[model samples]
Target: MLSMPLRLRPGDDLRGAIEAVLREHGAAFVLQGIGSLSVARLRFAGRPQPDVLAGDLEILTLAGSVSPDGAHLHMAVADAAGRVSGGHVAPGCIVRTTAELLVALLPGHVFAREHDSGTGYPELSIRPVPQASAS
Candidate 1:
């Protein structure tokens, strides 16, 4: 397991920036943990409305995984109000305060994105990689 501390600057899209980090790192192998992100957008499944979060909202919880290409990410975020929301992250979520993230890289694991016949959204697929492989 690896821990990463990330601070999103003002005007930075919370989810997009996270995915960018994964891309910069190549393949994570595994996303073991994340915590404390301020002013994030939480999109709920089955609901068209997305919550634009900001200000003193303690990150109640966060859960998600990154795609093998590192360009896509799926996550759930709950704010201080105890309301939980998540979905296919879009842009425009600015970091009002700061975001600190913890990520784990699994050297032997690989996560990729493929279109699902049912959902139509790119879904994550996991596979094992040779120890020396990079993607």
Candidate 2:
């Protein structure tokens, strides 16, 4: 396992940045994240669409798994008034100031997303990396 500390700058897409890391590492899990965001788009529980929160928002918590296919992240944020809201992290969550994240990279493993008939959504699939044979 490789632990990576990442810092995201302003105007960066939260999900996109994590996805980039996943693309490089193959499989990684976001242990935690703390930062500020100018815009947060989150899909509440059982909601088909994401609610957009515009303004200065503090990232209370962020964690999830990211695979080569995609990422499943959950985040909680507090508004300037201290109102807290959390849900499934979606795209377009723009960083306002900075984002600090600790990611754990899993070697010798591969993560894929497959369609789950029961859930009607794509889910994570874990498998060991195939061993390479010497000629």
Candidate 3:
């Protein structure tokens, strides 16, 4: 497992940025943990959940995982009010302020996405990625 530290800029969508990184790096498995900061435009499933969170609050925790293709992402975030909300992240969620993140990359595996009829969303299936041979 390889780990990298990330600092999210202001007005950026935390989840979106992570997904972008996964796509760029071709990460088969990604583990994002230990985030603290503020963000806005929070949503759960398909609906907005801002009412459940206080205004411009500090993110006590922000954690999630992503696939190489960025098909599935699960995340949870807490505010200064101590209220936590999370789910299958939706699009358009933006950062109110800033966030710090730790991203782990797995190179030996490849993540493939397929739609699950039961869950109604794309799910990841792990596959082995062949190592590069010395030229």
Clashes of 3: 2
Among all windows of ten consecutive residues in candidate 2, which has the lowest summed lDDT?
A: 20-29
Model 2 clash tally? 0
Which residues of candidate 2, in runs, are more than 4 Å off?
none
Put down candidate 1 lDDT per residue, 5-111, tens digits, no spaces.
55666566766777777765434532433445556565666767666666544443444676546445445566677776666455656655555666766556667
Write one digit per residue (lDDT tens) for candidate 2, span 73-100: 9999999999999999999999999999
Candidate 1 Cα deviation (angstroms), residue 101: 1.0
Evaluation by lDDT, superior candidate among 2 and 3: 2
Give the count of colliding residue pairs in each prediction.
Answer: 2, 0, 2
Arranged by TM-score, best first = 2, 3, 1
Tell me the tens digit of each residue's lDDT in model 3 across 1-135: 788887777777666787876765555333454444344445566563532343555554555556756745455666666677766555555666566777777777777677889978677777677877999
Off by over 4 Å in 3: 28-54, 132-135
The per-model lDDT (C-alpha) reads 0.60, 0.95, 0.61
Best-fitting candidate, measured by TM-score?
Answer: 2
